[model samples]
Target: MSRPDILLYTANTMNGWKPLIFLHEAEIDYELVPVDLGRKEQKAPAYLKLNPNGRIPTIVDRGNGDFAVFESGAILWYLAEKYDRFLSHDPKERSETLQWLMLQMGGIGPMMGQAMFFQRIAKPNGDEVPYAINRYVAESRRLLEVLDTRLAGRDWLVGDAMSIADIATYPWARSYFWATVSVDGLPHLQRWFDRLDAMPRVQAALQLPEPRPSVFGEGDITAAAQENAARFKDQ
Candidate 1:
């Protein structure tokens, strides 16, 4: 097989899956270069040059003079602009799409990540902090409520179609159960989640690199948390 023009440096985490899902939806040919977080490969000197933040989901666009892009949100924007798909050209609709994308970047992602850290990782490691857990979990739920409200009477986050906003947020939001947050009362959000969750592209994206174990299954949740803790231990 011929080499793809894009090389995605990623893991199986929620953030890592963002661009992967987009790539599938856009039907772009790409290569997946899995970064081994457990081995601290993301912090290696070479990887640092690509992503100074030392994070997953970085991309090297071979078709664009080998340009490198880091941060999940920025990567999504770059791909959307380059491919001229999944992002609208209409002024108002484009702005609305960006607004919802920013919500995921600045709000949902961080809040839910913190909630998962406190409830799953920290707690499992015997570093349980009740205040921290309560704070993040509550904030996560509030963000979900905001999404729930926005999703009411609508199928997508922006305009009348699925855009980068939905692509970026779905991975994080669908993992709500693992974060100890509930989506029980948010019917609209639940509907949206089910809609995206049932898509073949979304399902296929989750299996790339490898299939991640479900937290609800017999998987070792504590071990998973411990692995994640190592990523932020020095931060």
Candidate 2:
């Protein structure tokens, strides 16, 4: 069987960008089929056939001409399994790395999402939006502490080098500027992020598309996220 001809259908979503960031990091060759979420392209019947949720970041594995993968986390896991790199073969290390990957998928994604929701989308009527900010910011800080502990001595998520764990996190953790106002407290994680940023592969991935104007101050994604969420909820 030949290596599959692949089309990664994705928008510029954090989730969508996960696989692209990984593919670029791992130096995998594949075609990018930009799926415009703004045009309602993801909800199109043809696209829905690939992902029932009609989400971007779906991949068609043309080698079989039948297999397609959805879910950003699943896609990165699949790519690592297929490419046989960016992940460890050892059982313990592999499991550890996978744990971090899931942590980012489950922990960071939702917490930060709520941050975007209440802070930017809902048009909060207060100076602080204390409830929303405290909730997300606290959880985000907790998760970062977990990551920092894991990196207490190691340089990477896995035992030896950068792995799928890092790749999966590339889109979100790398957006630290958006997730939090300061990582100075997370010295280890901050260092880890800096190290990942310096890699040639990661550097190449960054060149693909700049992310959200750098997460410097608090963002205003709440309005957009709320609108999207309301639309999805209504549907």
Candidate 3:
């Protein structure tokens, strides 16, 4: 199937931003194909063919045999290996990068995602599940502390340079407050966040496919979310 040079199917969500950061940082040419989560577009048959899991942030690399890659972490890994960027060359450094990437992929990403769902999205829907909220928030905060400690004397997650681990982890960390987790006491994490926030590449990645509004905001998205929530509740 012919497609754009690099077609990214994604929503304006955290998981969606992960590979985007890498795409911009690596200077890979791509076209953004926004997926409307509010309308359940991801579950459509055509999209499901690209990603059996029916998730956003899937990439179809037309330059590489119309190859479709799904799952944010796997997408990042594929891009890094294909473009020969982010993932380190040294064995020890490469291992460190992959380990920290997995920390975001397996640990913080899932925990904080649930935290956001319960604390921010689900609550206003009259589905305030406190146990779920508290459990995820506490765990998400704990993960932030872990990142804080890991970044105490370092600038990046793995080696000296910013790798896929940092890219994979940044979107979730940037949305820490959405999880009701405070980073005030985590000075190192704050410093790292600020440092990355200042990067030109990171900034550009956050605002891909011009004309879309900023996804990161502390403002009210409840009404819009509720509309989408109603659809999800029926399932």
C-alpha local distance difference test of each model:
0.88, 0.71, 0.83
Q: What is the lDDT of candidate 2?
A: 0.71
lDDT for each residue of candidate 1 in 54-157, tens digit (9 for 90 to 100): 99989999989999999999999999999998899999999999999999999999999988878766776668899999999999999999999999999999
TM-score of each: 0.93, 0.82, 0.90
lDDT of 3 by residue, 105-169 (tens): 89999999898777555776678999998899899999999999999999999988999999999
Query: lDDT by residue for model 2 over 48-135, one digit each (tens)?
Result: 9999998878998886666899988888888888889777888988888888889888887777666655554353333457777878
Q: Which candidate comes out best when scored by lDDT?
A: 1
Sorted on TM-score, highest at the top, how do the candidates line up?
1, 3, 2
Judge candidate 3 against the unseen true structure and give its global Cα lDDT, from 0 to 1.
0.83
Look at candidate 3 and tell me the lDDT of residue 141.
91
Clashing pairs in 2: 120-222, 120-223, 121-222, 121-223, 177-215, 178-215
Q: After superposition, how far is residue 187 of candidate 1 from its true place, in Å?
A: 0.5
Count clashes in each candidate, considering only residues at least 3 apart in sequence or on different chains.
0, 6, 0
Clashing residue pairs, candidate 3?
none
TM-score-best of 1 and 2: 1
Off by over 4 Å in 2: 1-4, 124-129, 209-211, 215-235
- Best model per TM-score: 1
| Candidate 3 to truth, TM | 0.90
